[model samples]
Target chain A: MKRIALLGMPNTGKSTLFNRISGASARVGNWPGITVDLMSAKILMGGHIAELIDLPGIYDLHGFSDDEQVVRHFLANNALDLVIILLNSAQIDRQLSLVLQIKKLNLPCVLALNMSDEAKRAGITIDAHSLEQALQMPVIEISAKYGDGLPKALQAASNILNQVQQKPSPNTIRQLLEEDNQIEHEMERLIQQHVQIPTSLSNNATDTLDKILLHKWLGLPLFFLAMFLLFQFIFTAGKPLQDGLAWALDWLRTDVLEIAFASTPAWFHGLMLDGIYNGIATVAAFVPIIVLFFLVMAIVEDSGYLSRAAFLMDALMAKMGLDGRGFVMMLMGFGCNVPALMGTRVMRSRAMRLLTMLVIPFSLCSARLQVFIFMIAALFTAQQAPLILFGLYLISFITMFMTALLFQRQYKSVEPFILELPPYRLPTAKQILLRGWLEVKHFLNRATKFIVIGVVLVWLMTNFPSNVAPASAGTYAGQVGLLFAPILDPIGINQELAIALIFGFVAKEIVVGALAVIYGMQGDALMAQMATQIDWVQAISFMLFTLIYTPCLSTIATLNSESKSSAFMWLSIAWSLGLAWLVSFVFYQSARMLGF
Target chain B: MQLLSQLESGQSGIILAIEAEESLFHRLSALGFRVGKPLSLIRRANFNGPLHVRLGSTDIVLRIADAMRIQVNTR
Candidate 1:
């Protein structure tokens, strides 16, 4: 089997090409000991099985950017049969510098000019034959988006692989570390000789779009509107799917499964229905929202507005020691922290990524909002509920920013801001759907086990010894809650709420359900009983704790996987737990002192 | 020579020298910033933020602080 790696600057349609060739068989998994995963697929090329690896888009192989380092590391470690260097046909003047740098490595390579159709639309043309002669490598002009010239490109790669020359040594990469200022001059000369770009080309589409999109006054508002519509679409479209899944699961557990398991032991039935089935249901309910969120996000990212959004928000985000892209991820966190955390890949700087990860958990994701909404409705009047919810949002933002400001210094590295604004192009439906499906698949593969284990563990804790009532004072979960009751007393979280917090760690959406079960009541009855148990101040404190405590198990698993560091994951958990306790303690103590 | 950040919107300039650390200099050069290459400031973001710059049809967004490190000749 031969190996081929797709290398290119960003926005070069590398992923599109990989997806087009690999189709639905692409597999994304982390290489052993690598910090992040690269998408790879096994495809038959020219009657031979070949492994195609799609690397992260990099600006320069010799540069110190995180993505660059990743690419360089991958090249040094893996002996590839061919490196297909993809370049944007319309932006070849600048992109060719990377090609030259890679050429100096003396590796077997081919040059692929992608987006040739867009280049033709823009009145740009490249002399592929002359360029190939000059570069002494096969040059393939292909439009990955439109399926143009891809077969020829793959055939050229396969031809080179058939030769099977000796793999280049790692020392060639070290040789590229030396700066070569002459590559730019050579690139200019090559373009001047072979590339025919019309002088003073007018009727520019990107410029006209950028004029309005990046307008000094209108840019920020347009960005917010785009974000607003995106989230609104995700939720509006996803809500019905989520509700349908929830309804089906509930019906299955109660009506269908209850009848089927009538003859089984009561303990076995409860464990199967309440423990395993509930765990699977909780993870399944999130599928629609996660898939929809990434689908729209892919469209935005591919359309090139995502970088513009970053450009517009940079100055404001700079104060918190974050890149503008971090702001977008934080907003996405409000919907679901798991996807938002995965979305941090948009930011290339390691420091920005880590800092963003620290802050996103405090975004008051919708799961936590469910808990707040329930608590607010049960405790406060209709008018007061909205204002109190608004207050919680304010606290969320404050805590997010505070977290960023606090951790920025420790993670500070000299990461300069340099972002590319690719020309706008309508993303293909196939590409968007592929991205959404792959992301959902990845989420399911990586996060489902953690979520199921967490939910089942909580169930076990609340229903152990097989003698006592589930979630009752005699159970293991109840005993543990009592153990922490005194420690939590300062924040007004009693033993019952303490037990709910354990279930909340699995998922915040379960907090209300857990409370209802622990109290052995349902719906309105549980709300009335809770209204009599905890007052307004205690309710507010509990809400605060819910807002800032440890993220759900899936998010924790995502953090561990995304960061590829258990230490950072543990730190994130401890930090959020500490912050939640401090905030709730302060608020509860001050309110008591003020006679609220 | 004036800093790239000092160039007015819509004004084009020739790159002179980039006063930055090795990493940033390498990054800028790879993005087509050379001693004689031409680039234009498309726009400045609000509140003294990043500048939208175009170099040979490639548009880049750089913070004002980083933009200050790139020297260019307006003429």
Candidate 2:
């Protein structure tokens, strides 16, 4: 099987092409690393088993952005036999620059001129033959959306690897055009013969849609409308499934527990039924919402609207010392902080990326989202759950913005910003589901391994001091709790809550799992633990700390890889920990001062 | 020049410069909002403040002051 690496800037239809060839969304995201996440997919191209390594979206080989470096290093290593560069023909100039750079690498490459349907619709036409002749390489024109020219493109790629004969020289043009003016002249000539840019592609459908969707007065309304629909889709899609699963989990916990452990000792019964099954059930409860969220996010991402979102958010983003590109990383942070931090590689300046990485820990990932919702449901009513959950998100976002401002004042490095703005296209449903499932799978893997281990460890810590009778304070668990109690005192978290929260910090959903294991909560496991052990003020403090706390281990590793330095890696870890400590301290102290 | 929200869609204009009173001048320019680029107003945000405008195929959202500073002549 030949290995082909698909390369392109974000939103140039690489994912679209990959999806068409492989019958997969390949992964979620049209922008940057969201789709491939720096991994290769095993694909069969042309009835032959071939591995497709979908590299992250990168603008150039010259830059040092994290994913760029990943691609640069990968390409330079010459690990693959074929390279397919997808370009948006409509934005030919900007995308062509990348092609020009990729061409200079002197690799076996195929350039797929994508989005030709839109280009034609916009009155633009590309001469694929001219582009091919100009570069002395094969150029395939395809529209990944309309499924036009995909077979030809893939076949070209396969043929090039198989039956096609390469010229003896393969024609490496080092001084290809001789001068900048000559190069421009040649490019202009090629476009003049083969490409035509439309004067206007305006249509009443889009114009009418834009009137309401892109309305100045109504734009924001529409933006919120889009956002609300996304959230509604997530909630409505998952709520019933979540309820049925919860009912099944309840049966597993009680009826199944009684039958399975009827002959076991009390301690063993508690360990197997409450500790193990409880952890499993806790993870299962939120699985629906997490999967649903990822699905909607994948849809938004694959639709190419996420890039426009970055554009729409540039003003607010710039205010916080980030460019539109930084928002790309932030959106990734919504899935998990680790990738978001890793996504910061797109940021040019080390300082900006570092600062953004520091604050990203504040954004709630899907893992933590379930914890907040569970607590809200348990403490208040179910109706209040959504509002409080929404408030927490707002608080995290505002805090992240303010924190960015503060960090920028303390550092002075400028990031050279160049971005690719992709036109909106509907993402395929198959792709969204596939990408969302990968995320769901990753979360489940964590839940099974680290989360389960974390719960048991916390349970062991809190259960060891069973001195008085039914696990009293003299046990090892109580002793450890007493030991950590003072360390947590100033921060407003009790030792037990702190232990649980720390375990949760590994992956936020595990907090409930740990608490359930510790306190033996039923039904609404997370909320039950929070209410029984943590007061309202402490709960709020815990949530704030959770928002500002150290990123999960996966994020830590990703940050380390991005920074490529132990020092910078630890700096983020230390900064987030210190910030979480301070934020929680203030919340706890201020609340006490105000007689809460 | 009016804020981006005030401009009709598809209208083209040139950015004279950024008029931000705050510290957004350099940031905006770094993001390619420098003077002399032909910018088109796309959409505006809440209260005609933050505006979505395009420069060189890259759409950017900027505040009213940033938009106002980039003097534009409607075509």
Q: Model 1, A1-596: lDDT tens per residue?
A: 88888999998998998899999999987764258889999999877899999999998876657888788778766767788999999888779998887887788888999988888986688999999999988999998899889889888988888885776765555445433424645676897688744223222687888889899998889889989999999889998999998999999888999998889998788778777888888778878988998898888888888899989999989998998888999999999998899999887888789989989999999899999989988888998988998999999999999999899898774778898888887776777888889988988888788878777888889899679888887789889978888779999998888888888988998899899989999888899999999999999999999999986888898898889899999999999999999999999999999998
Pairs that collide, model 1? none
Task: Tell me each candidate's TM-score.
Answer: 0.70, 0.50
Clashes in model 2: which pairs?
A338-A555, A461-A477, A464-A475, A464-A476, A465-A474, A465-A475, A465-A476, A466-A472, A466-A475, B19-B69
lDDT of 2 by residue, A68-180 (tens): 76675555433456789988888786678888776665667888888888788865888889889998678988888888887788888777777554422212322321243
Chain A, candidate 1, TM-score of 0.66
TM for candidate 2 is: 0.50
* Per-candidate local distance difference test: 0.87, 0.66
Model 2 bad stretches (over 4 Å): A1-211, A240-291, A324-357, A364-395, A409-418, A437-456, A463-472, A475-477, A506-573, A590-596, B1-75
lDDT for A60 (candidate 1): 81
Error of 2 at A344 (Å): 7.3
